[model samples]
Target: MRKQMIDSVSKVIAENENTSLFLVDIGVWGFRDVLKNYSERAINCGIFEDGMISIAAGMSLSGITPFIYGISPFILGRAYDQLKLDFCYQKLAGNFITTGAAYDFSKLGYSHYCPEDIELARTMPGLEFIAAGTPKEFEILFNSTWNDGNPTYYRLSNYCNKFDAKVAFGKAAVIKKGSKGVVIAVSTMLDSVIEACGDEDVTILYYTTLVPFDGITLRENLVNEKILLCEPHFEGALLPAIIDSVKDCAVKIKCVGVPRKINRNYGTKIEKDICFGLIDKDIRLEIRKFFNN
Candidate 1:
């Protein structure tokens, strides 16, 4: 997936003279060779995450398409003030390419963990927050949003494409059809949701983009009103929006995800999944609870 994103972005930068890439000590090994191979186009901004956002914003204002790249926590979480003030405040467009979704690199400890990153991003305006669960979806997101006029976030998760489905960023895709209820899986949680619902009769909606969530697709899913939100991030990240979407309709909804409190849990992401009730059994339990109610 990283190769796909890098290759696509590199090709774009090579072709477009006005576009530039800003790197901040992340994915150096993955992209250093390819980007440095571009020479003048890629700027190794070092450890200054906030500074990079400002630089990207300034460049964007100057008619140069600047893309900020690096670790998820630093690029988005650390440089949030700059993001809010520079790009979002000015309503300028800059590409934010982030690696490591949530706990993709859990060995770095909880400080690097970012289940709440979207919670912070959700407060900002005019930013498109996207979590790509599959390689094809990642490629589509890059292709669709590369030079768009909105501040876009491309969160690269550890999970790849598990099943074949049409690729659309903000719009939800119904991978499986059912009549009992609907299971809305966010980002890479698609696999877990699939396994959990194998024995049950439920429709699975795979949503990639967080902001600018496709309301039209959502309305289509309203036929099966009961929704069980399955996400890898903190619970309630999408609850507010989900509630707002179905305000005029009668719908039963429940969100199953990590808690708002920081995860002091240890070991790998899967272990953390067990710690936070994101395992398949827990999700199945939640599904039963939501439908049986």
Candidate 2:
């Protein structure tokens, strides 16, 4: 997925001579070669995440479509002030390409873990938050934000899978159709929900875009079925939005994601999933419980 994102972005840069890609923390694993191969002007801002965002904002002010690449936590959490003040507040046209969403960086410990950035980004005016669950969706997001002439923040997960891009920019894609209930999975975690409920009597909605949610489609599909929202991040805005959107219906709603507990110690992604009761078995059990209720 990282290679695909780099290739797509590089292709865009190659086609457009006016655009430049600036990477933050290119010294990190999996990105060193991308930094070296791309002919476009790229910069390694060392470990100073906040300074990199500031510089990117300045570049945007000078009429450059700067792509600021970095880890999710560093890009969203470390440089939040710059993101809020310089980019979102100033309304600059910069694309924040953040890798490692949710537990994607669980192996790196709590310091690098980012589980609330999307929800945090929702509060920042003029900042768009996009999460891609599949390679095809990533392609659409890359193209949309890169060419849209607006400020955006994009989050990518290390886990890659094949999915239909029919509902790329809309509210969510209905992966499975059923009359009993509706399971809404957020981006990367959509595959898990499908695996948990194989051949079951339920509908699955894959939400690739967080902001600018498609309310009409969401309302049309969520009627008369129990709603379950599964995500990798902390359940703050996304879950509530689902409930609020379908408030007029007689549907029951629940959210599955990181628990409301601070991390005392960090472990692998699988370990974190187990700790938060988000594994396949647990997910299946939760679905069963939701229906049984």
Candidate 3:
């Protein structure tokens, strides 16, 4: 998925003569490779995440659409002030491409894990948030954001599995059209939701865009069905938004996501799996409970 994102961004740069792609990288594992491959467009700022964000903001102010790439924890967590003040507050045309959403860096330990980036970014006004489940969906969202000229944050996982790119901006896609219930899984966890549904009467709503959420569609499809909102990050922005949006509906809404606890153990992929309840069996159990309740 990382390679695809880089390749897609490169294609966009090559094809769009007016737009220049500037990549800001921290000292993450694959930073050098991205820098080496896209030398002319990519910039290595060492470990200064906050500085990198500010630089991107400046570049955006100068009429260049900048795409800042970094680990989730550092890009969003470490550079919170810069992101809020420089990008969100100033309303720059910059795109934050966050890799390893949720527990993608589970093996790397807790400092490397970022489980609440979505919630954090959603709090800031004027910043658009998107979580893509597949390469195709990401392509659509990435290109659309550039055309839309919005301050956007895109969360991507390291690996790519084939998924339907039939997703629409500001709305969720129904992966499986079922009537038993609806499981609205945020980007990285869409596949798990599909598997957990099994033969049950469950519909999977892959929510790619969060900020300008598809309130019209949510109101249409989530009327009387049992609703479960799943995300890899901690429950905050999206969860509250879902609840508030559908508060008047007769649906039973439940949120499934990472527990709001600072992890003590060295963060690994396994730890992330545990944090988001991504284990197949565990997810299945949760789904069963949601239906039972």
What is the C-alpha local distance difference test score of each model?
0.81, 0.76, 0.74
Local accuracy of candidate 1 as per-residue lDDT tens digits, 120-224? 788888889878887778888878987888899888877565864576767888888788888989888888899888778788888888887766676676656
Report the C-alpha lDDT of model 2 over 1-293, residue by residue, as the tens digit: 67668778767666665566766655345445545765446556577889878887888888877887788888888889999999888878888888878867776777777888877787787787888887778888778677676778888877764554565564578787877688888877876888887777888878877876665667777634688878888964586567667777776778888876667666677788788877678889988888656
Ranking by TM-score: 1, 2, 3
Stronger candidate by lDDT (2 vs 3):
2
RMSD of 1: 1.6
Checking candidate 1 for backbone clashes, the offending pairs are none
Error of 3 at 266 (Å): 4.3
Pull out the clashing pairs in model 2. Answer: none
* Ranking of all predicted structures according to lDDT, beginning with the best and ending with the worst: 1, 2, 3
- Candidate 3 residue lDDT tens string, 1-293: 67668777667656654444444444334455545655666666666889878887887787777777778888889999998999888977787887778667766767877887877887788889888878888888877786576788888886444566587778777677666677887877777777777887777777889887766666667634588887777754476677667777666777777778876665566656775577557778878888766
Model 3 lDDT on a 0 to 1 scale? 0.74
Q: Tell me the deviation in Å of residue 5 in model 3.
A: 0.6
Better of 1 and 3 by TM-score: 1
Winning candidate number (lDDT): 1
Clashes of each: 0, 0, 6
